[model samples]
Target chain A: MSVENFLILGLGWAGIFLPTALGAIGSIVGCARAGQAACGALLDVESGYGRLVGASALPSSQTIYGIVVTMQLNRQVSVEASPGLFALGVLVGLALLCSAVLQGSCVASAINASKSKPEVFGLAIAPAAIVEGFAVFAFIFGLIISGGIPGTLAG
Target chain B: MPTATNYYMLVASLPRMPRTFEVEQVPISRLRLQQRLEMLNEEDTTTVQQMQEFLLWDRQHPDRTDTEVLQEYEQLMQRVRNVLARKIIVYRMDVRTITCGLRRRRLGMDPPSGVGQWVQAIRENWEHPDFRLARQHPWIPLVRGYMEAHQPLQTERQLLLAIWNQWTRLADRYYFSFETILLYLARWEIVDRWTRLNESLGRQHFESLLTEALGEHARFPQ
Candidate 1:
């Protein structure tokens, strides 16, 4: 593919990935706030299974978004033409995938925690934020590579 | 004619019990009224502290089941209700107790006397930890302000509206908190046995008390 074509494609992918990642971050933070409130309320007074059930249900959407973005990036890379570019793309994609998987697992654990203690929901947030860091690194790296590829490669 | 002091001491000194199945057998209506009284009396040092202690113990001992903790809480609440029912002096004292619990705290050390003090007191009480957590949202201050400012008097219609508004706000907070916790749990996959057991117990105690309180007004309308 031409350099412009590759650049355009990469930019398109970035466009989708960036916004979704940002949105996921927002949603995660909102979920965290909700978790804090839930735990606080549970501490103040118990609300039974209803409280646990409700608190456990709020984090899945963001996890799914993270997974989808990384998977899509994996699909976008071309291995035959440029091995280095392809490898970098795969690395970034894997980074994103790992973050999504870890974050998703954290969310699940948090739900389980809420079911029993609802009070400890606040404690579940640290893991989710940690996973977000990996996603951020992968995203920034991918953007830089995509930006540079257009300039260095011959059409 | 047990004095408030006597009732206080009894509740304070009541021995802790192990898990029991009596909770399931107990009529929800009776439990509901008793729970309401217990919740209101949460401000009472004797009762609130005990409840807090029970919760703390359950947290420490993770082997306890939700069903067991809830049953014990119900029994305690039943005992409290029975005491309040049997003694006229205690009952009247409880009325004062409820008023005090329900009374708003003054924003300033010395709020203007009369209606203003009462209004401010309600505002303060609403903002207190127990009632504040029930609503679990940023909107409490605004809603509380409106309720305090309106001070609907005399008419049952106005009173109902005020109560409804307060209830709605509390319900919103309750649901929001629930949703938030669910999201975190789903993310974390936290399947620890002890944490789950404690949570279930805490939830049971909370619900049982709320149901007991709400049921009373419905069953016995003046």
Candidate 2:
């Protein structure tokens, strides 16, 4: 393929895969870290099986958010829409990924703190909530931009 | 009420069972008064000291479970607050006391106030022999700051009941306190202003007590 065609094809694949892949990456790493913290926490607490489990899963939401955004961006990878896809895909994907990982760390810390001192569990989750805000922004922005893309099916 | 076995023991020991029964009932009230008086003598002692005494109590009363101790404690607490007559307070207080004992703190996500000061104070005195501080928790500073800022001017036992009522009214059922919050509260025997506050404002405005006490630093609603 010619260089131009090759670049277009690359952009097309990057548009769909990058957001999904990066989001999953973020969720995986984030959940894993939080889960590790949760496991450590379980040893000390008399009982909080549900809360600890729920906290570790908090970072996993970014992955679903990423998937929804990616599905929205998936469409005819024509040259006309390629640039939009690239920008939305890469930026939103990275944001979701970063937010997820950061949220995971926050949740892990929250779980650990709550395990020892459960009263602070609500407050400890505040940082994670703040981090979730960025992911919501990314999701909304992706949704808006996807609407503007020509010839793409509704996501 | 003495059991049949206890009655036999009284008869075997005293020979005059009816007189012994009258003397026992009178002395039981006196014994309680004496115990309360003794407790008042060291009311200013630290949590570590209290914890030690509790442990000794446990050891001495090998046949009594923690539930029995808690029941006895709750009876004393009820008398102190004059709530034995209030049926509503009694029912709610029972649940709160049970929940507090089981959970060791209120259940919620809102961070307690004054966590920063609490963490700082704990770190400074981390070498104390009674309590163990978990240094690795990431939210330690935040938790400490929240508790220090929000902790009520009451005894540890009262604080448990306060949060029980406060958090329940907030309708955020799944609240909890950091272990350090309990540790810090246990360390002191602060005079309770809640009783006065409740008298003036009624029990419903317990949130206002937190607000009034916290002044500016109280961020959480309950």
- On DockQ, the leading prediction is 1
- Kindly state the number of residue pairs that clash in model 2: 31
* CAPRI-style grade of the A/B interface in model 1: incorrect
* DockQ values of all predictions: 0.01, 0.00
Quote the positional error of residue B160 for candidate 2 in Å.
33
- Runs of candidate 1 with Cα error greater than 4 angstroms are A1-81, A151-155, B1-222
**Residue-level lDDT tens digits of model 1 in B1-222:** 322222211211111111221232221232332342342333243544343343244236667554564465446555543232223223222222223333344343332222212334444555463334234333334444444665422222232233334333333342222222221121111112223444666788877887788875534455
- lDDT by residue (B66-180, candidate 2, tens digit) is 5675575555444442221232233333333332222333343222211122434334434432113325222233333344456432333353344334323332221122222
Compared with the true structure, model 1 gives a TM-score of: 0.26
What DockQ would you assign to candidate 1? 0.01
TM-score of chain A of 1: 0.47
Best by lDDT: 2
